[model samples]
Target: MDLKETHISELLIAGNIDAVKTLTQQAVDDGCSAQDILEKALLPGMDIVGQRFKACDMFIPEVLRSAKAMHGAMSILRPLLIASGVPMVGALVIGTVQGDIHDIGKNLVAMLFEGAGFKVVDLGADVKPETFVQAILDHQASVVGLSALLTTTMPRMAEVIQAIKAAGLREKVRIMVGGAPVTADFAFQIGADGFAPNAASAIEKAKQLV
Candidate 1:
């Protein structure tokens, strides 16, 4: 691996936005494809961030900082990736279930998904079940992620699954549920395909779903 590639990962994990911006632009100028920059630099950086966060070596705020850096690089690469026809891992629709307005977790997951090469359609906070269903249809998303931070709003995740099923699109996508109040058992009970307690595992689950 080149030193620049390692520097990109280091800058990202260190949450150095300006450095990442400079490096990404430099990579592009040096004839590195958008896909190469992503696969070699950004994604691998975010993967380390995910591992560190999961291992408690990094905190939420720190992870968000790293994600912000990744976002910066992505902002630079997005249009280029499209122009060059870079293939995405998949499309994913993610939202905080209806009745829950919390967005920190949802936003983090969305950014991480983007970093991992998923075309994410974020429905934002306090999202209704119908919105999730419509997003899946609109995006033809292979994976749907439901997040609910409140125990009371956790059932809204189940309602979203029901709505998708009612729309006859249950077979069209794999559904994953998450948030502080969600569990594997609850996900199974609600007919969710997967459950992740945090952003890193959420990426893993979403990738598996797609």
Candidate 2:
């Protein structure tokens, strides 16, 4: 089969790992740059997968499979992509707030940021404020992304922001918050520098805020 960009994306979505690897390698061998395969095929395919996931048209299994396919292709392209001189946009530390075990949003945002060329340090779910502060200190990150899927845990977002501010890291770092129940106004109320409705917008908001 012809390994067009669309075809490559379809293979990714279908979770045809071997097919994806073969087609992606073929695309590379056919005089296509790995970056072209990444930007045109893999990243765009993940974008669609994420959107479908958000819309409930696709579930976690499909998303994970697509991510796996993307990962496979990226493993082959990393050195080439790095040598092509695409600099990282910035570094980020991300986590779901304390008491919140929901990480789907956090994971999505992490993926989007990575695709957007930002180096992300994921702190995982149920992260305490001190954990985030420690991550910031350790990573020396420019942006901190907080995700909370529950209203009860939403307050922890503010707490984390406050802790960061109290530790004198607030001025140096940009704080961005997201999750189902969070609003722009709440972001302001909680002293967050930025807010986004979802992962894509979170990536855009991070760019703007940083």
Candidate 3:
């Protein structure tokens, strides 16, 4: 990798949003392709973030900051990537389940997925089972994430999964579940492919799922 790519990776890991954008543009001006910048710089930086977060060396706020920096760089590079026909890792459909209005965790997972290079289709909060099923079909998503902060809403995750199966789409996408009240045991009982305890694990699990 070029020195600029290495610098971009360092700046992104440091969560230097402004520097990330500036250097990404400079890399482009210096003849670095957007795909090259994404693969060599941004993705590597986020990969480190994932590793550190999994190891507890990094916390949620710090990970979020790095994600923000990644977004800043992507703002300059995503259009170019699109124009160059660069494909994303995969599409992900995510939402806070029905009867659950809290989206903090779901939103964080979405951002982390985006930082990890997935094309995320976020359905926001209070999402119905059918909505999740349709979003999976609509996006042709490779993964689906269900979130619920309340115990009452946790059952909705299972319902959503069942809906996917009813629609004959359950086999098409890997399902993941998370939230304050969700556990891996519950996720397994519900037939989910994975469970994410936090944002970093969400990225890791999604990677494995894909």
User: What's each prediction's TM-score?
Assistant: 0.61, 0.63, 0.61
Error of 3 at 153 (Å): 0.7
lDDT string, candidate 1, 38-143, tens digits: 7778777887887898799999888888878887887787677555533478888999988887775687677667767888899998998899988998999999
Q: Provide the lDDT at 152 for model 1.
A: 90
Among all windows of ten consecutive residues in candidate 1, which has the lowest summed lDDT? Answer: 78-87
lDDT, candidate 3, residue 38? 74
The TM-score ranking, best first, is 2, 1, 3
Strongest candidate by lDDT: 3
Candidate 3: regions farther than 4 A off:
1-87
**What's the alpha carbon RMSD for model 1?**
5.9
> For residues 99-121, what per-residue lDDT tens digits would candidate 2 score against the true structure?
98877568767766876788889
lDDT of each: 0.83, 0.82, 0.84
- For lDDT, candidate 2 versus 3, the one ahead is 3
The local distance difference test score of model 2 is 0.82
